[model samples]
Target: MTIMCSAESPNQPEIIIAVLAILLTLVFFLIYKRGKSTRRSILLTGICDSGKTLIFSQLVHKKYVQTYTSIKDNVGGFLIDNVFLKVVDIPGHERLRYKFFDEHKSAARGIVFVVDSLTFQQDLKDVAEYLYNILSDDVLAKNKTKFLILCNKQDQTLAKGSNAIKSILEKELNTLRVTKSRQVESVDPKTSKTSVLGEHGRDFSFQNFSLNIEFAESFGNHNKDGTNDIDQLVKWLLKIA
Candidate 1:
C-alpha cells in the first residue's frame, strides 16, 4: 500500500505579513507619485491694475516691471536667503483669474493678494468679491496657506493703510456673506463647491479663515519707505520660504 501525504497550509501570520508588506509597498509608491506629481507655488493674485505684476517682478526678477494689464500668469522664482521659492503671477482679470488660481492652488504654499490702496474706496466691492472667492476655497484652507494682503501704492497720500483696509474688508466681507449665501452655484471650477466662510450667527472677520493672513502696506516702486515698502513683502517671503 502506498503512503498518502499532504502538505500543510500556509501559516496565517505569514500570509498576513506578506499581504501587509504588499499593501505598504503600494502605499509608499502612491506617496512618491503624489509628491512628484504637483508643483509648489507662492501665488501672486488680485484684481487687474492691482500691482501684482509689479510686485511679482520685484520679488522674482528683482526689478520693477509693469504692464497695463496681466493677460496671463507669470511664473518664476528667486532665491530667498539661499532657498529658492517659486512664484506664479496670475492675471487678475475677472474672467481669467479663476482658471490660473485653480490650476496652481493644489501646490500653493502662500498667496499674495495685492490691493490698490490708492483706489481702495472705489474698488471695494470688486476687491471684496474677488477676495471672498479666494477665502472661500476649501483647498486654500486645507493647505493652510499664508496670505499677504498687500495694500500697494502706500506712498500715495490717499492710500489706505493696512489697518483701515483690514477694517473695511471685514465690514464688506460680513455683508458679502449674506450675498454669497444666496448663490446656488458658481461658474468657476474650484470655487464652485466653496466651504462656508465664517461661523453662523457671527459677523465675518478675516480670522474666520484658518489661513495665516497679514495685512501690510507696501509700494511696488523703488522708493522704499521704512515699513511702507517692499521690505515687508520680502520679509514675509523669507518667513514663508
Candidate 2:
C-alpha cells in the first residue's frame, strides 16, 4: 500500500474552489441589497431659534440615539449602512423669508417647523397663515413629507401649556387659502374657485400632515438649550429619516 499512495486527495482543489465561489456570491448579494435600500432625506426650513436649535443639536450629538449625524452645510445625517438621511436647518427670520420659501417649494423629504409658544401668540395667526401658503404650493404638497412643529420655551409661564398652541396652529392652518386674485373679494364669484388642498398641493390643515409638538425645557436657560435635549431632537429626527 505504501508503494503508490497519493499525498493529497484529488477532490481537495475542487472543494477549495467551491468554497471561494460561495463566499464571492454572498458578498455580491450583500452589495446589491445595500445598493437597493439606501435612503436619504433633506430637512430644509427656517425654524431654528435658541431652543429649537438646542433640541436639534442634541439629536445630532447624542451617542445612544445612533440615528442622525451632522453633515456639511449644517445638515444632519441619519446614517445606516444602506441608508442615509440629510437634514437642513433654515434660518427663521423675516429677512430669510424669500430663501425659505424657495427651499420649501422644492422637493424636501420632511419639514420641521419650530415655533416658540411664548412668542408665537404675538403674531401666531399671521405667521401660521404664511407657512400654510408655502406648504400649499403645488410642488410641495405632492412630495413625501413629515411635519413637526417644535414648540420651544415650554418652561416659560404662559408657554408651558400644550393644548393651547396645538389648537392655535390647527385653526390658523385650516383658514389658509390661495386665491387667483390678490384681493380676497376679487376671487371668482361664479366659479367659487379657491385652491383647496389635494387639487394642487397637500394642505397642512387637512390631517394629511402628521403633527406633533415637543417642548425643550433646557433650550436656552442653560447655556443655549442645554446640549442634552438637542441630541434628543436630532435622534427623533433620525428615527423619522
Candidate 3:
C-alpha cells in the first residue's frame, strides 16, 4: 500500500478559487460595458413651438413634419454616421418640461435646447427661465451635462443668428440670476433644489459652466438649395452618440 498510494493534488482549491474569481470579474466588466453603451440617449428640449418636434421629425425622416402641439413625448432610434442613438423629443409646454427632465435626466447624454430664432426676443424671459432651471439643476450640474443651444428656424429671413441669440441669452440670464438669487434667499436652502448660476458678483456666460455648452443654427425646413440645413446638428448628435 505504501508503494502504490499517490499524493493528492495540492493546488486544487487554489486553482478553483482563481477560476471563479476570473469568471466573476468578467461578468462585472460585461455588465458595466453594457450599461455604459445603453446610456447613449440625447434629449431635445425647450419652449413650445420652438421647432423641437420639427427638428425631431427632420432628423428621423429627413423631411419637415407639420406638427400640432405635442401633448406627449416622441422618442425614436436612428443611425447617424454609423452610430446608433436614442433621441427623445420632450413636449416643450411649460407644465410638462420638468416632468420630462426628471424622467430622462438619469440617462441623457446631452440636451439640445431649441430656440425659436424668429420669436426668441418675445419669449426671452420664458426661455431664460427654462434654461436657468436646466443649468441650475442639482443633478444635471453634478453630472456636468452637455448642452447645445440650437437656434432653430434659421431659414426665416428675420431669424436671429447664433451670435445674436447667444448675446441675448447671456444678457437675459444675467438678469434672471439676480431675480432667482432673491427667490432662493427667501426659501430655506435645505428645501430648495435650485442651484446658483455662474459665479457670485460675476456676469453669467456659457463659458463659466463646467459643462460643455455650445451654440449652433438649424433650419428644420428646407433651405433655398432644397437641402435640410441640419448638418451641424447632425454632426453634434454623431459626436455625442
TM-score-best of 2 and 3: 3
Cα deviation of 22, candidate 3, in Å: 16
**61-168 per-residue lDDT for model 2 (tens digits):** 443222222222255655633456565555555566446546533545556566666777776765675566555566554443455555566666777344676667
Q: Please provide TM-scores, in order, for all candidate models, with all chains considered together.
A: 0.77, 0.58, 0.80
**Residue ranges of candidate 1 with Cα displaced over 4 Å:** 1-39, 184-195, 222-228
Most TM-score-accurate candidate:
3
Candidate 1 lDDT score at position 14:
93
Q: List candidate 2 segments past 4 Å from native.
A: 1-39, 44-52, 61-73, 78-83, 104-107, 176-194, 197-221, 224-239
lDDT (Cα atoms) of all candidates against the true structure: 0.81, 0.51, 0.83
Model 3 stretches astray by more than 4 angstroms = 1-35, 188-194, 222-227
Predict model 3's lDDT versus the native. 0.83
Clashes of each: 0, 15, 0
lDDT-best of 2 and 3: 3
